[model samples]
Target: MPRLPRADRAADAALLAGLTVADPQAAAAFVRRFQGAVYGLALSITRDPGLAEDVSQEAFVKAWRAASTYDVRRASVLTWLLTITRNTAIDAVRSRRPVPMGAELLDQLIEDSLRSPDLAESAVHRLETERAIAHLHHLSPDQARAVVLAVIGGCTAAEVSQREHIPLGTAKTRIRDGLRRLRAAYAGGDLEVDHG
Candidate 1:
């Protein structure tokens, strides 16, 4: 086995900056440099070459869309891109699996998880769920509903828009803002929920 050469961090960062502005040459170069690694990771996670190809493409698209949000202080370009690939692969795999529970059943499960403490093996999961639910309650009603439909229901933003009778952008904003609040609150320990 041979060790791969170290990444040129400055060059990669410049490529990502160019990608943020839709520079075609930078996009091509970035893809060329990372496609093999991205596809390899996707294939390992998805275990399907065709799905891996799709995941790899989607991961690159997501990277392009999110390029402006990339933080050099947080991670190198390769590490950040691989994280996107990993998440995209997981989402692609999850989408293929059928959820056994219907909406009512899912709602019931959430309710039970919150109120019942007797499920000894899942105590940690239940606590996390409880905390999440508490944070959801803190969001505006519209934001909370949008987040729930898209996240818990696994519905897309378009679906949430249709269900909520709002524009697509509005639905996306609600979900994004809701999640941002939850993340901030969780990170800052600002949630007023009783964890005990």
Candidate 2:
């Protein structure tokens, strides 16, 4: 029988079923169909393009391995694949030793975002994100580093302490105080400058 078109859930299920059975065409089709979304989610979670690419590859491998467990009634193929991508990306992030994220790094990211042709509407969203990141500069360097490590790097308090070579309590205090200040600044709308 001829195959159905590639855009619908049923077709997605077929592609996954084909992948489970080790069909090369199905595997190729599946990757071609979802690579963008998979990579996008991975990049968003990991925030590093190189690591995101690695995570994306791992997610696809995992999906291929666990293809038999996919259930259409529970979720769509895209959702299932993206979940694997997210988990993989988070794992990658957690496994790495987090370094301090400074204003220079944030500025470079913003500059890269501004230059991307893909930033059509996301430019506004990216600007908002840049604004929030810029607010980190208002913090003392140590507090800012602590907050970035704990929040953006997804490090636990103990991990932060270990990385920063500080006491756990101090790391927690920094994160807490930094967040409190940021909250106040955001609420008061006092931090309008990008400072990059």
Candidate 3:
């Protein structure tokens, strides 16, 4: 008998169900399906490769441990998984910071900021995203990659430096210069203007 191809949702749901049952195969499949996405999110938030790896692992472990409690009604498995990953990344970041007053409120604010925007706001956000993507072409290749990694990829200058095999200062300069050029272009100023 030929096996049926599962829809993405169906595949995720089946994997999640397997998770609840402590099925090793399901766990492997689930992790395989979302590792890149989870890691990307963690990397973006932590901006540190080592910390992102830890957070990604912890996020997957937490999801596995609480698999039975997952509510498909509330969110798709991928959405739920990413939310856990994001929260875990946020917590990891906060823990490394010097504790100040209102930490709890800050955490809450960050979580709130991550929530989905409504239709009106999403439309504006989409246009802004489009504009940003368009502006990337005006930057030099290295500068554009650094800017995109730091901004869209959620990487720190250090991460960009490491990834690009360049010195940290060079990475920072590229990102700064790229951003300034982008800002100038958007503001209708001369693109070739250099303050240095």
**In terms of lDDT, which candidate is strongest?**
1
Residue by residue across 44-102, what tens digits does model 2's lDDT show? 66778999999989999999999999977655677678768867876787678355344
Strongest candidate by TM-score:
2
CA-lDDT, candidates in order: 0.72, 0.71, 0.71
Q: Which digits, one per residue and each the tens of the lDDT, describe model 1 over residues 124-172?
A: 3345446667787777767877776665455678867876689999999
Write model 3 residue lDDT over 105-145, tens digit each, in one string: 43343333333333443343344435555566566767877
Instruction: Write down the lDDT that model 1 would get.
Output: 0.72
TM-scores of the candidates in the order shown: 0.47, 0.49, 0.49
Task: For each candidate in turn, give its C-alpha RMSD to the true structure in angstroms.
Answer: 9.9, 9.4, 14.6
- Please give the distance, in angstroms, between residue 108's alpha carbon in candidate 3 and its true position after superposition: 18
Model 3's TM-score against the true structure:
0.49
Candidate 2 lDDT score at position 105? 51
Worst 10 residues of 3 by lDDT: 109-118
